[model samples]
Target: MASYKYDIASGAEAFTFNSVMRACTKEVAALSWCMQHGLIAAKAVCSRCAPPPFMRRKGMHWRCSRSSCRVERSVRMNSFVERSTAPISKLVMVIFFWASGTHVTEAAQHAEVGGDGNVVEIDATSMTKKQKYNRGKKHADY
Candidate 1:
């Protein structure tokens, strides 16, 4: 598997939609990409065991390496997408769209917002800004 380093400083100008799509075409690839981008942790320690066993990748979850302690932890734990149920690919696309300043509706469409009975609700209230300290147009007397 190839490795990828996504520099946020470079911005969207460094990557095209096709490139991002190709990089995250598979679940493993997407996970790897997220790891490279620091969006996910590559290693985890099992909290259930004393002396903390190292966790190994077991499908979508991490399993404790100790034979006696078979504890499991989500790969997304403490990551940027921890609460998100969306597929890694879709999430990556959404991130790309957001970083590129694409319109919310268009970004949602491109990212295929929801799937398999999953619902994605977006709050755009923060997207609009209020004039700070009433700095914009002032009210005039009639």
Candidate 2:
């Protein structure tokens, strides 16, 4: 069984459950967070003939602004969500559910995944990446 933890000491004030839902299910939220936090971006200068723009949403991915570049980047390229095999939506759903007072096991089921797991998500301002990484969160949903 896998376990997850959320850091909700004092700084995790901004992330309401609804916001998390939007981020997980909507490209705009995903892309917005990725770009705002610098999680995904290609070279400002294109490898091709034209200078590619910054990171922009193209369908389900963050691709080079210049459509011709064809450079698609993972939204989780560098953030906490980089390696989990689970769907982003499931991850976010479980985390929010847990924070909203749902039990860990129930949260995982709400995410529609098997096994028992604990999820802990702290506000970006409250905890450091090292702290989050230390809590056994091998993968993130959003």
User: Using Cα atoms with residue i matched to residue i, what is each candidate's TM-score against the true structure?
Assistant: 0.63, 0.44
Kindly list the per-residue Cα lDDT of model 2 for residues 18-95, writing each as its tens digit: 566567676456556445545445324334444445766555556666646667766566655678766655656665
- Among these predictions, the greatest TM-score belongs to 1
- Candidate 1: the clashing residue pairs are none
Candidate lDDT values, in order = 0.80, 0.57
lDDT of 2 at 102: 81
Give me the runs in candidate 1 sitting further than 4 Å from their true place: 1-16, 104-109, 112-142
Task: Name the best candidate (by lDDT).
Answer: 1
True-structure Cα RMSD, model 2: 16.7
